[model samples]
Target: MTRAYLAFTETGLALAKRLAVALPGSVARCGRDGVSLAEWASAQFVHSDALIFVGAAGLAVRAIAPHCKSKTTDPAVVVVDECGRFAVPILSGHLGGANDLARAIAAVCGAVPVITTATDAHGIFAVDEWAKHQNCMVLEPERIKLVSGKLLAGQPVYYRADFPVMGTVPAGLFLADTPEKADFALTLCPTGQALHLVPRIGVLGIGCKRGTSAETLEAAFAAFCTRYGFAAQAVTAAASIDLKQNEPGLLAFCQAHGWPVRFYSAAQLRSVPGQFTPSPFVQSVTGVDNVCERAAVLDADGSLFYPKFACSGVTLALACRPFAPDWRWQNA
Candidate 1:
């Protein structure tokens, strides 16, 4: 991760240099240029992984006030005084990993790290933090407060995971056998309510006509997810033949959803071993009998959840990779 160190004084600059030993790809900047701190913070928020302010806590707060967005997307922010008395995480404690970073800074600079997140303070089950640790895509991010609130209030929250749980389940979260018995879910498929965590273990394979419209392709994508009980937001990679790599319509569709398309040559698709519903017409054109089915399962070690299906001038297939969640192992 990258960090931008903004030091206000020469003493703070020296501390910034010492703190730089912890972060590899970090840049330290001084305030001698008379640049606006607000504008500086705005620019750093877009690309910086974390922002370290070596100044007063109120100064850091005022500089980042307008640039502060959601805790989910914002970069980790920490403030440390020039004397290195305390390292406090001012924003994005859990999901953005500011709390852990503050402790690391404190260890390096010999400062006290102050953590104030309710879930961490009480040692409860934080669904959002666990989801990020598991590399799962959080659906209904707005509803994260509901799960956290329930846990903080000492209320029982039931959850269902389609995959295997490898560690001891955290307190306040019960593992339910079915979705009907749960308050939230941990799966890529559709669940009952708003709180659900989708693991990024799904592979989406696509095959479409040469000149299909982006609108048609997008509509087909939404419908495909709805009809097959899958969440469109859970797709990690979009696979297709090499010929469609430059296809304008396909590129636009994936780009709109922030999904990168993975292109495989016809030979690569053909080399994939498994049962496939071959199409002679497709083979004559692209040198592969099955593009969608072959592309989906080739990179994933799991089976194809859906066979080749055609709709809206676009052919699609869905496949899943094996996912295992361990409560003890966190990316933090």
Candidate 2:
């Protein structure tokens, strides 16, 4: 669990104590009231995901904002009254903020929670959480900010493949067709279909030996991700498993990646029209199919451009696309 810090007036210290008991992570309280604001802020800066202020909103904001990381990927900030009856999400929900924590506090204190972020209210795809689950790195975190800005202002967000996002479009901005133009574009796993906007595809592919151990597979996959600059969460789906479902390695791979193993049966592969290639070993071992050939064949809506590298044992494919403007996470 991430560490959380609470700096409150004497009246609010009891609330902080309650929070420390309920929230499993480490918690701290501010010292003497007369201490310098800088001293207070700096004291809790280490490894704390949130800075909770129990009183004096203006002072709390000013004192911590300057100390926060410039881009603010960590250490969210919040403010509440001494009664603990009103909780406000001041910063950093996606990077670990007081949004949920504040809400938890509010539930305990019966306070009103102020959460204005669209994703949380609408219950859509939280790109950051997905990234966290997949262990994928975000190339451009600010793009999500721009995307949310447009959404909050009632702008249209276009998804090439209807990728689920946090908020709904505000009517006027949603463009249904390619208008020979668009305000912004989002691609979902590159279908090669004629899209009005630029393509942004997320891909997941996998390969594996007949009987690789689950532990070996997981360690190898993690190492593979670290070695190649890629986020595990960006994996949209598992691309192969038909011949290897019985293999513990393949099943473990699917579970680890949080994807349903999409197997292409031999008959299904035969139906998919492609410049299909077959390997002797693949045909001999699996008896019914080829892995890459089947994957390419199955992806009828989009063309599969095979990279020149061969992943031995078990192969798990993931999107290589760096995150774009729409794919971002922010504090709620």
Candidate 3:
């Protein structure tokens, strides 16, 4: 569903076409003789996840200047020369993935990637980039600059993780035993501390009575997470029995939070092995001894971090993915 737009002038239209062919699901847009470049670029910026301008860097800057927002929301913007000699990420380089996109484009065009991010240039680990790679939500994204700045200045940045992290720790980052002693921390649960990176690794398994109001479900879910130290931003998905697939409150809650819901059949739920709370009434009605626990760990091998907690006619459980260090971009 990701759409990339390639905008080009007459001099670079052929190269843009080649790039469009190289990148699947990409659209090649050229400035017509009568259309204004600014207007055309503006339209592309609004409609695309990434914009590649096959022309001057000045043109790319001027086109995106009016529409540029924060790195969190802006689309990746890359500028390539008409001869395809260099690919430069002009805006939203790290958080928006412009740097990676530029490198890919450069590789295809046999050109050089002109990445200038301080961390990338100096071969230091960028926390923001790593968080993005891990599908984690940075609660305080501004603090990333503070941590990266420390590393850039040759000051060791301390870190702590609640779960086991594999692979050798990147240079410039040291592991600390406690949050108080660390410069920053990585966790799935809330710590009420600043400079913490929360990974989106929690899955919620929910069961609700029919006709439950969305408000009731929301309040109960929020309370359950708050009571158990779960970070709301760390929740990545939800699950429930297939029988409740059309339940209005459940659907509404997941949809509102942009979490995808996975529905398991009674047989599917029964096949998962775990020590789950069994309810005769639930089994009589749904043909499954448990829904919340089984649904939470259906697809992945995970631990039931939070057992079933019931409130306001709703039952909930939580599961966590195994922690693994992502070191693919350590030197990039």
Query: Which candidate number has the best lDDT?
Result: 1
Instruction: Please write out the lDDT profile of model 2 over residues 83-148, one tens digit for every residue.
Output: 877888777765464566677768777889888667667655444443433334444565555545
lDDT-wise, the better of 1 and 3 is 1
What TM-score would candidate 3 get against the native?
0.91
Q: Report the lDDT tens digits of candidate 1 across residue range 1-332.
A: 68888888889988898888766445455556665677678888888988999989999999889888887788999999989989999988877879878888998989998878888788777788788778787778788889889988888888888788887888888877667877778787866774888888778899999988789998888888878888876788789999998899999888887877899999999998889989999999999999999999986657788888789778999888777788852344
Q: Please provide the root mean square deviation of candidate 2 (C-alpha atoms, Å).
A: 9.9
**Candidate 2 lDDT (Cα, whole model)?**
0.56
lDDT of each: 0.84, 0.56, 0.80
Instruction: Name the weakest run of 10 consecutive residues (lDDT summed) in model 3.
Output: 1-10
Number of the predicted model whose TM-score against the real structure is largest: 1
- Tell me the tens digit of each residue's lDDT in model 3 across 147-184: 88999999988888776666778898888766777766
Worst 10 residues of 2 by lDDT: 189-198
Candidate 3 regions with alpha-carbon error over 4 angstroms:
33-47, 330-332
For each candidate in turn, the TM-score is 0.91, 0.48, 0.91
Residue 311 lDDT in candidate 2:
46
Error of 3 at 302 (Å): 2.9
2 or 3, greater by TM-score: 3
